[model samples]
Target: MFALRRLSTVALSGARCKHSLPDLPYAYEALEPIISRDIMTLHHQKHHATYVNNLNATEEKLSQAISKCDVSTAISLEPALRFNGGGHLNHTIFWETLSPKCTEASKDLMVAITESFGSFDAMKELLSAAAVGVQGSGWAWLGYDPKIKRLRIAQCANQDPLEATTGLKPLFGIDVWEHAYYLQYKNVRADYVKAIFEVTNWEAVSKRYSKAAC
Candidate 1:
């Protein structure tokens, strides 16, 4: 329920703060039958933790660059900052937006989804297409457009954060990276994307929508 600390914000600060991997809310096996224990274990312990570590390192380098007035060096580091920072932010939200229990979307969220895409199922179809269509490692997201007061489906390449890249407040996201599903789902990305909904934490997504829509 906490907000994610974006890499941009962290880099702009005068002081450097070490980023740590947020612990999974449930055990590795909690999401099983949908996402395997081995996948979750590696995803959290190895992949996500790597991002956190790299983000911390990137921020340190950025701080040094800024202190030394090395604007060129700082600019050169932006890609690393975006990649690692986005990875941390994205995965943190991803973990929170999934659960082992079955839950339904909140009425308000469903209404919004219907209003935006004609129906909830239609929205899912669109989002699924976007997720599966990602050319390589990336994510598909259901996000809220604050200015338009509507929900939107979008995709980002690599670890590009949706908000940072597209100005959309993320409601829910599907990580389409090979590391997310390759071990169990193999090259069947669509199947993995579909099964993810089985563990989708709609309630958590609803809470995010409520805040973003406000």
Candidate 2:
């Protein structure tokens, strides 16, 4: 009986460890005018969901290797875990950092942006340019440098997590993957970049900044 109970516990733990797609706070259509419903639906339900699923699958294989002390198999799973885990993390933050309603920058976030970039407008220009200039599929971010106690703009190629690549803490991010804007804005990525700000959730970004600072 005890052996059976132990086995059940291990199985349950493994099942609970699997990565799952997180639900958005708002409806798929809520971000309209800036991001179309179709884009949000497909991007979240399909693209991000795929990453979460794959990450879970890869991690399961990795766990089995670790339990057996198979170093080579563990090492072989690194790339998939990084790619898929980073995708899940980045997309999670991306969805949270936006809203349909236009909001003023939070006092804390605004102050940091002003102090670091000299003004919010400057930061916007810099971040927007980075978003538009990504050579391929990537992301543009407004991140906080804890060591410098300042804000900075950075870019990541593919699905690399911002914090993992740079020491900066991501506050807000914009997805530059063609899949992000191709359907609605087509090849006019500049327009997509321009429109994204209209719905930027400064409140959420501010919370992220505050948490990172802590």
Candidate 3:
């Protein structure tokens, strides 16, 4: 698993700080055929990078506002903080939850999926439908509901972080934003959603599930 730096920590620190874009675990060409090299390069280097840069800038301003006790300025910065922070967090998890090659779910995860959604295929079906059904740019998530010890499928519009928006620990996320698929699949979002499964990093997701379950 990648060492994910949770963006919420940086946002709440109230100190001048910078959040750098994370390097991809695999080369941009790794997930090729399913997700093209061009798309991956642009998505990671361009799109996700923008979020990291904006987040660092926003946090710097937030720190200054807090230090001055400028209540109004601090309040005004909340939307920026949430937007950029969510973008950083969502993309960080999205990148890690994907792999160049297909992988299988851990045994424990398979059992949990059976209990939660009847079968592993059923979970994929639900998650795919949710991802394709998104109205616009957003993410479809398979999240762990700790209170019930169950897996749940949920969608978050735009860059909204799944955990913050739905109180579910994000185990796997499918980014349905245009930037994620437009270059490779054109306007056919469903095709992109369907193809992403070929490279789904189930091992990483299973680890996340285990942690969230605990």
Candidate 4:
């Protein structure tokens, strides 16, 4: 398992890195049945791309504010920074969270799950419930509390990034935004949330967990 460098980059360096929409690791139709080609296409090309573009624009404005030593303007740009930056961060993790390959959790991850929520199945149910209960557009996350060295389940409203908002290193995330599932699942958000695990990239998730534990 490797470190979650991509998410680290997303969380820490996006504004400085000249953000761009990452290419899908697999074909759009690869996650078929769980997510249709049309949904994936629109989600990545349109939605994720918009976040990237907006993040760049936000950072440019922020840089100008900083150059002028304009504290108020820089502070005002904080909302835009967090919104567009969090949107970019969240979607970056979301893309890597799903895959055509159905990899099983590593032994380390399973142990952590057992310790945190009794069992892998139980953890899934808990996370799914969190995803379903999101009042509106949001995200459900399996995160690691580095300070306490424990696993935790958390949900965030809108595009709020997990680490920035809660100090939890996000190991896995489920995006419950309407655009994420509306086209294929319609208003059945719960069904879409439950079905995402079918294409879950556990190897990637395990890698993130391993890194977070360190």
Candidate 5:
């Protein structure tokens, strides 16, 4: 499986400090009707910013614990590390996977999808289904299984990072958190999940797939 590097920079105060929120690639309203400006604004500035903040804080504490040679304390921080770290990682991919502009699936990516799922439409349907099927706050992902050399649709509960939990390199992800679509789609998460395809940045996903396939 491809190694999913930690994107967040860790710098403790007594140790070192540089983790910051990543700027959105486009304006808040770029996705237009597919995703509302209010949704984008809150999702990125508030929700995602919270994750970054929490991750930095968690890392800071972990660093302190490590410095004291407190293995027990460091071990106790696993939940925070997994949750906040996964949140940050998932959001990073989510933001990049979506675009205001429509993007075509690359030939290689399309071939993989078709081979694995019968057709592009079939794969899209399955991915959408997976997203809509999430029980709670979770994600649906198009991930590459390096072992079988297959493209797969997987669902993850809570903020579990795709690669970390499943060892599948994530190509694209659809967040099912209420914070992601509650404003626009309301309780109709399926609609939101289906509509997300319109704004999907397939070019970005294709590039991720290319790397994962390698």
Candidate 6:
């Protein structure tokens, strides 16, 4: 029985090694009437899943190349690993930082936001504009700036992780990827940005802020 349990653990870890998608904490339809069920399902199961899959595959190759000391092969795989890995990481955080209702921001989170951006409303305006004004596929993030000891809103193109690119710890992220909102809000990304507030998981965000500060 001990041996069997060990094998099961190995199997589970191996499965995770291949970049399996993280399960959503809530149902696909839970974020309605902000995000549609169809969009959530496809975005999570298809788009985000693909990134996770590709990242895992790329990492496997990277591991093999590194173990074999094949510098050229490892170098060639860097772009793929960075892009897909960053996508998976960012989306994982994004999913957790949202819910299905307009929950109040945590008091601690509110205090942080106020300290960083002057007020929650100010933070909202800046984050919303940053998200909606993204020229193409990208993400807008509320990140902790260690240097300044404050939160800041920033944007990144493609699948670049906020911390890797800007040295900020990501507290929350808005996926401006068209696939995130195209099915529901079409080309009007502003509508999606506006609606996202309803499902913003401020409690989770507050915890991240606290951790980052520490």
Maximum-TM-score candidate: 1
Task: Give the winner by lDDT.
Answer: 1
RMSD of 1: 6.5
Q: How many backbone clashes does candidate 5 have?
A: 3
- Poorest 10 consecutive residues of model 5 by lDDT? 1-10
Write one digit per residue (lDDT tens) for candidate 3, span 96-139: 98999989999999999999999888999999999999997899
Give model 6's clash tally. Answer: 0
| Worst-scoring 10-residue span by lDDT in model 1 | 1-10
Query: What C-alpha lDDT values do all the predictions have?
Result: 0.93, 0.90, 0.90, 0.89, 0.90, 0.88
| Candidate 4 C-alpha lDDT tens digits along 1-214 | 1256455444454456688899988999999989999999999999899988988988877776665557899899888888889999998888887899778889999999999999999999999999999998899999999998889999999999999999999999999999999999999998998899999999999999998897
State the lDDT at 38 in candidate 1: 97
lDDT of 5 by residue, 133-181 (tens): 9998999999999999999999999999999999999999999999999
Please report, as a residue range, the 10-residue window in candidate 3 with the lowest summed lDDT: 1-10
Tell me the lDDT of candidate 6: 0.88
lDDT of 6 by residue, 28-139 (tens): 9999889999999999999899998899788877766665558999899978987999999999999999987656767877888999889999999999999998888999
Residue 63 error, candidate 4, Å: 0.4
RMSD of each: 6.5, 2.9, 6.8, 7.9, 6.5, 5.3
What lDDT does candidate 5 reach at residue 125? Answer: 93
TM-score for all models, in order of appearance: 0.93, 0.92, 0.92, 0.92, 0.92, 0.90
Clashing pairs in 4: none
Model 4, residue 155: what's the lDDT? Answer: 96
Q: How far is candidate 4 from the true structure (C-alpha RMSD, Å)?
A: 7.9
lDDT of 5: 0.90
Which of 1 and 4 is the better model by lDDT? 1
Clashing pairs in 3: none
Worst 10 residues of 6 by lDDT: 8-17
